[model samples]
Target: MVGAWIWNRNKERVETCSAKAVVLATGGAAKVYQYTTNPDVSSGDGIAMAWRAGCRVANLEFNQFHPTALYHPQARNFLLTEALRGEGAHLKRPDGTRFMPDFDERGELAPRDIVARAIDHEMKRLGVDCMFLDISHKPEAFVRQHFPMIYEKLLGLGIDLTKDPVPVVPAAHYTCGGVMVDDNGRTDVDGLYAIGEVSYTGLHGANRMASNSLLECLVYGWSAAEDITRRLPLAQKVATLPAWDESQVEIPDELVEIPDELVVIQHNWHELRLLMWDYVGLCAPPAGWSAPCGALPCSNRSWMSITPASASRIICWNCAIWCRWRSLSYAARCCVRRAAVCIIPSTIRSRCLTAARRYSRPWLT
Candidate 1:
C-alpha cells in the first residue's frame, strides 16, 4: 500500500498521507442497521476502504444481532450486557411469562444467535414492539453489587434495574464477516493489514460467541505487529507521492445557497438505513436479499448525482455507508444463490422460495 487520501474535516479539504503499511482496526458495520448497539463511527468505513483498495471481503452475510439491547425511545444504542442473563435474568413477555424455555432447553443461557432469533420470532408472532428481561426477583443488593453501572444507568433513565423489568430488543451487534485476511492479518493488498472487527479471519463462522471478538483482536494484533516488523527492513520507501490537488473544484456558495442539498443527503442516508433494516436484517428471506440488490443501484445513482465535488464529512460517511450497503447486498445475494444450489435440497428450495414469496412484504413485491 502506498498511502491514503484523507478528508480533513476541520480544514474542509482533502489531504494525502504516505505510509508503508496501513492497519484497519475500525469496528464493525453494525451502524448500517437502524437498531444497533454500535457507535455512529462504526459505519463500515474500514471494510469499504479495504474493498476499494482491492481486498476481498468474505462472509458479509453473517451479521450477529445481540439478543438484548435496552429498548426505549430515549436510550439509543444502550446495551444491556449478557451478564444480566447469566445472573438469572429471565426473558419474559409483557404478560410476565417466560418464553426462552419454549425456544431452547438452555433458556436464557442459549447462544446469542438462538436467543436473538427467539426474541425476533416472539416479537413478530405477537406483534409486539419489545420484550422484557426481568431480574426483579433477584435481591436488590446483589443486583446493585454486581451491576452498579447498569443499575445506575437504568435508574437515571427512570427504570429501576433492581425493581422493574427492562424493556429489550434484539439489535445489530457485530459484523461476523469482513475484509478477508490471513493468520497474520494481511489482506490481499500488499502492506495492508486489517485486524479486529474489520477483518474476516474465519474465526467466527455463522455466529460469533460472546467475547471471542476481543480474543481475535488480541491475537491478530500481535501477529500483525510481528509480521510488519519482519517485513519492514525489506520494504522500500516511496520517495515521492502525488499531492492532493483542489484545482477546478467547485465550492458551494455559503452566502447565496440555502444548504438545501443537506436535506437530500439526509433523506438518502435515511432511506439507505431503512432499506437495510427492512430487507437485510435478521430473519430475512431470499426475496429480501433480492430486493436490496435491485434497489441499491438506484439509491447510489441518486446520491452520486447530487453530491458536490467538495463533499462534507457527512457526505463522505454516506459514501462509505453506500459501499458497505452494496457489499452487504452482494453478499446476501450470493448467500441465497449458494444456499439454493449447494445447501438446500431441490424440493426444499422450491418450498422455501414459495414461502418466502408468500410472506414477502408488499413493498418488496
Candidate 2:
C-alpha cells in the first residue's frame, strides 16, 4: 500500500506513483472463462494485485453465469440482456418446446442462477450446443421499440430479433466474490480500498441479483471516497520512495526472440482459460475438482522459475492470471468441501452431479 510500480505504456518504461490511498475499480475476472459477457480488459487484475498485497479474497466460487448470451460464432460474448425475458420471452428447446416450467415455476422469469442452471441442464441433456430464446411472439414494433440496440445488433448478425428465436447460452457474467473489504471499502492492507467488482463487500452473497452490482459500486465508491478524505489529513507522507529500477533486468538481444516467448505465453493463457471453463465451471462436480487445483501449482511454479525482473508485460499479465487462477481453484475446492459437509442440499447436489455427468466429455479429462 506504499506505492505502485506501473508500466508506462506510452513512455515504454516503468514509473512509480506514491499515494496515501489507492482504490481498485478494475472490473471483474470474467475473461478467465472461455465464454463471458465481459470485455477483454476484465482479467481480474485488481483482485490479483490485492491478493498479492496480502488482502484476503473470498467467495470467488460464486461466479454468476448469465442465462442468455448471443450464441453466434462471431459474437459469442455479446450479452442478450435479461430484459427480453422480463418482457415475456420464452426459453425453448430446438424443437420449439418450452422447458423452464419443468425446472422452476417462474419459468423464464426465474432468478439468474436457476435460469442459467436450467439452460445448462437442457443443453447437456439434449446434447446440443445451445438453447433458444423466443421473443418472436411479441410484436415486431414492441421488440424494436423496447430493444432497439439489440434489434440492430441482431440484424447486423443476420438474425431478425422480432421474427426469429435467438440462439442463446449461459456465459460468465459477473464475479460475485472478490477481495474482502469493509463497509468503507477498506481492505486488509492499510491505505488501500477496493470498490466496484474488485471488492467483496458480502453484498451479493452467493448469488448476485441483476442491477444490484451498480448499486454496490455507487454506494461503495462514495463511501470509500469519504473514508479516504477523512483519513488523508492524518496520513503520513513518504519522504522519498524509490523509483523503478531495471538495473539487473535482462532484455533479449534479438527482437525475433520476443515473438517466440509471446507465442508461448499466449498458449499458456489459452490453456488456463480452457482449464477453468472445463474443470471449475458452473457444474463442477466434487469428484474431478482435484485436476484443476493440481494443474495451477505447476503453472505457478513454471512462471516463478522465470525471473520476473526480465519478464515482459504479457508475461506479467499471465502471472497475474495464474494468481487469480490459483485463487479460483482454491475457491472451487472450498465450495466442494462445503458441499461435502452438507452445506448444499442433497437435491441441489444431485442436480449438479447429473449436469456434470452429462456435460463432461472424455477428452476434457
Candidate 3:
C-alpha cells in the first residue's frame, strides 16, 4: 500500500503551490520515458510542485539510469534488480561475448550508472539494438533462491534462466536533484518543508550508491520529525501573524488549457530521456550538465527543438532498444528491411536535422 496522509477537507479552489509543511514521500522519477525500471507513476510531481513554489532546486541534471532492465514487447519496462547482478551475472554482447569484464573490474556488479553507460556505449558503438545479462550459469536452485521472480518471469518467456542469458538494458530510473532543504526538511520559506524524493540533501552526491535512497529517506524523515517535535511546545513564538487579504483576487471564467500538445509532450519526454541518458548517466562532472541546463534559455530551446525530424526516429530506436532488452535477440538482418519498405514522406528531412546537428553535444545525457 502507498504511504500517505489524507486531508479530507475539500478546498474551494486548487492550490497553486503548497504552503504548509509537507513531507512528499513520492519516490523516483521513472515515468518520464517510454521505458523505465520504476513504477509508471514515479514522475517527480513533488519536485515539479516544489519548483513552482519558488524553492531552490539543485542537481536536477543528475539522473540515474538502471543498468539492466528487462525488455520485451509486453514487458519491456520491468526491472531486474541489482541484487541479481550482485550475486553473479555476466553482461553479454550480441554474439554471446561476455563484455562487462572489459569495462570495469567489477564486471556485472559495478555501480548502476557506470554499468549503464558502458552498455550504452556498446550499443551505440556497435549499432546494435540491445545487450544481454547472463545469469543462467548458476544452478537452478540458486536462481530460484536469489531471484525467484526473475526465474519465474523468464520461465513464462519460454526461456530457462538456468540455461540462457537474460536480455537487459539501462533505463531512466532515478533523479538525484530536488528542492533544497535544511536539517528539518524545511525550504528557504518559513512554514514550508519538503521531504523524500522532492528534497536534495547531498546524501547521494553525483551518483547514488545503491540501496541508500531508502536510508536517506528514513534519516531525513526522523530529523524533520524531531525538529518539529522540539518546536511544537513553543508554537506561539510568533503571535502576530499576517492577515488573509484577498483584495484584488477574482476567479477567472476561462479555463486555461494545460499544455495538452500531444506531440510536444511526447517530444519532451523523449528528449528528457535522451538528455539524461547522455548527460547524467554516470561518472559525469558535477559541473558538466550545468551549462546547457543553466537556466530558462536551454529549457526554452528544448521546448522548441523537438520536431518530427528530431525525435520521430526515436520511436524506432526505442522500440529496437526494447525488443532485445531481455532476450539477447537481434533483428538487424530483416527488421530494418520490413520497417523501411512502407515509408513514404514528402521528404524524410526537415529543419530538425539542422537543429540536431547544431546543438549536438557529448554532454547531453
Candidate 4:
C-alpha cells in the first residue's frame, strides 16, 4: 500500500496517511504554457516536488504541441483529436484556400511537428487568431457517423461541422521529459516510484505519437503494479517508520501574503507565461530564448524575496525556472552542435564526473 500526507486546502493543515511505498504519477506540465490542452491541475507539481527531493529531470526539451486544439475561449483546453485529421480534414485559410500542401506534400497527414509549425506560421503571417480545419466538404452523414461526439459538441457550441470549418490552434499538449526513472518506474529515492507522465522512462525520445504515449502509459502501469506486488511481502517486514512531528516548528499564521507581495508573484507569473509562450514555445531558437532565459533568474530572485508565507508557490516558481533553464541549455547545445567545430574535453569530463556522483546510489530498497 502506498499512502500520502494530504494537506487540507481550506484549513491548511498537514495530515499523514501511510503505506509501504509512495508513487508520484501527477500528470504532465502542459499548464506551464499559455495555451494548452491541460487541466489546471496539470501544473507540474510532481515534477517540481520530485526535483526538490533531489531527483534528476531529463529531456524537458521535448514538449509537444498538438496540431489541433479547439480555438474557442469557451471550450477551455478542449482537444480536437488527431483522428479528425486522419479521417480527411483539410487545413484551410479563412478565404477557403487549402494551405497544408504548400508547407508539406503530406498536407494534413504530415508529422505533428511539421503540421504544428505550418499552422503556427500561417497564423502569424496572416495575423489571425486561428486557422480553420475543414471536413465539411465530405458527406454530412459520413461526418456525423465518424465523429458523432465532435459533431454534437461543436453543434452545442453553435458550430455545424457539416457547413463551417472548425477553428483550431496548436496548443502545448504533452511533456516528454520528467523525473528520470528506470524500467520499473523507480526514482532515485528509495521506496519512491514515479510513473505515467510524471516519470520520464525514455520511451518517447523527442516527439510522442498520440497512440504510442497512451500505450506507454498502460504498459508502465502494469509493469509498476507487478514490481510493487513482488516487493510488498518484503516491505511488510520492514521496521516501523517514525511519525511526522508537528511541534518541531510553529505553524505560520497564514499562507497567503499581503497584497503588495502577492502582486509581485502575480505579475511575474503573467510575464513568465507570456515569455514562455512567445520565446521558449514551438519554433524557439537559441538566440530567441536568450531574453527569457535571462529573465528567469531575475524572476526567481524577486519570488525568493517575497517571504516564506508563500513558500509552496515559490517552489512552483523555482520549478518553472528549472524547466526554462534546462530548455535554454538544451537549445544552446543544439546551436553549438550545429555551428561549433569541437567540444571542449574538460567540459565533457566535468559533466561526466557530476553524473557519476548520482549513478552509484541506491535506487530501490
Top candidate on lDDT is 2
RMSD of 4: 9.8
lDDT of 2 at 297: 28
Backbone clashes, each candidate: 0, 0, 10, 0
Give TM-scores for every candidate, taking all chains together and pairing residue i with residue i: 0.80, 0.80, 0.63, 0.75
- Tens digit of per-residue lDDT, candidate 4, span 120-179: 767877888889999988999999999999899999999998889999988988877788
What C-alpha lDDT, on a 0 to 100 scale, does residue 270 get in candidate 1? 66
Candidate 3 regions with alpha-carbon error over 4 angstroms: 1-20, 30-35, 109-111, 157-159, 229-260, 283-365
Q: Candidate 1: misplaced stretches above 4 Å?
A: 248-259, 302-309, 313-365
Model 3 is weakest, by summed lDDT over 10 consecutive residues, at 326-335
Model 2 lDDT tens row, 168-273: 9889898888889999999999999999998899998766887899999999999999999999989888545588776655544442144455455556667767
Off by over 4 Å in 2: 95-97, 249-259, 297-300, 305-309, 313-365
Angstrom error at residue 159, model 2? 1.8
Pick out the ten consecutive residues of candidate 4 with the lowest summed lDDT: 356-365
Quick one: how many clashes does candidate 1 have? 0
lDDT value, residue 191 of candidate 1: 91
